[model samples]
Target: MTIKYPAGGMVSKDVQPVDDDSVELTLRDHPLIRRYGRLAYLVIHGEPVPAGRPRFTRQGHAFDPKRSRDYKKLVSEAAALQYHSELLHGIPLKVDVKVYRHVQSSISKVERAKRLSGKHRPIVKPDASNYLKLIEDALTGIVWEDDNLITDVSCSKYYSDDPRIEVTVTETGAKRPNNLKEPHY
Candidate 1:
């Protein structure tokens, strides 16, 4: 006989979307704790490198002090940004991470307007998933004791004059917050 996995573990399986049934945590103002800026990156051979693989010199030894410092600072900020008294455990967590990044300055005025109007979507590097990974790792202990307590996650990227990440985390089976209108995120 085959055993069935639990249904609530996946966002795709969510019966009712976060709607009016979860707490909303917004962290756009806090710089270090809010979003990972696209401009902050590790450079090698004059090109910024993505996290995952280690960079090396001619001798094949790797060292990236700036990158290490950036990561640690981000994690520390994550811990500091969390709501101190909130009990974020036991229940399944549904998070919505909307990443706001700065648009390149080289684009023409018309193009910039289009971007600002949301008529044209910016397709660039520094993938959204990478930012989400950093957030998950950084918020592990402070947010919920462990990252495994998270049951659902929603992540997106957008262009903004002020770059930031708007994070909303909610626990299932909890009383809904009073001032919710739309379920859409």
Candidate 2:
């Protein structure tokens, strides 16, 4: 934590000498582990899929073939990237997700559009919420102890020539200085 003061504030330049062991000067209120922050990120290229709709068989077996395949691919991509990043255990996190969908061909029918064309901002399907489900499921065992630990999430969908999904995960309450129990003295 940094403190900023206006000119002529009460901070004094001199420190008066006191009896040894008579006083304690504490700069931080919490352990340095509170400040240790880590960011785990990955970008999956190709068409993104929503959490698959479940299909039940006559034998009462349920499955989501399409979404299962998609999550498999997504998880592999995330695992490859997350292998080098720190795994967050029971820590509240902030998840930022961005989905870029392939531009549809129907926009061509509309004519005489300025710089604010479909490419800059395109209307697409497969709700952002669906993407969240798939992503959260895929990342469960790899990045965190459980999906319930996520305290916050932000996600959006967009149009792009190269379809992809980018996920950025941050440990929200973690502080800096990796060694938590080390004595400052």
Q: Using lDDT as the measure, which candidate wins?
A: 2
* Error at 97, model 1, angstroms: 0.5
Tell me the tens digit of each residue's lDDT in model 1 across 1-185. 22122321111111322233435543333343346421111111111122344468999899545664355345435344334534456656666667666777999999888887788765676776666666666566656567787777777766766555656665544666789866877
Worst lDDT run of 10 residues, candidate 2, spans 2-11
- lDDT tens digits, residues 1-185, model 2? 22112221121223343334423423122233235433566666567777767788999999777656556555555455434434567567888889877766565534314212553554445678878888887787777668898888999877666677888887665665686687778
How well does candidate 2 score on lDDT at residue 157?
79
Residue 144 of model 2: what lDDT? 69
Q: All candidates' TM-scores? A: 0.55, 0.61
- For candidate 1, the TM-score is 0.55
Which regions of candidate 1 fall more than 4 Å away from where they truly are? 1-65, 68-72, 78-82, 173-185
Candidate 1 pairs with clashing backbones: none
- Stretches off by above 4 angstroms in model 2 are 1-38, 109-124, 173-185
lDDT of 2 at 173: 59
lDDT for model 2:
0.63
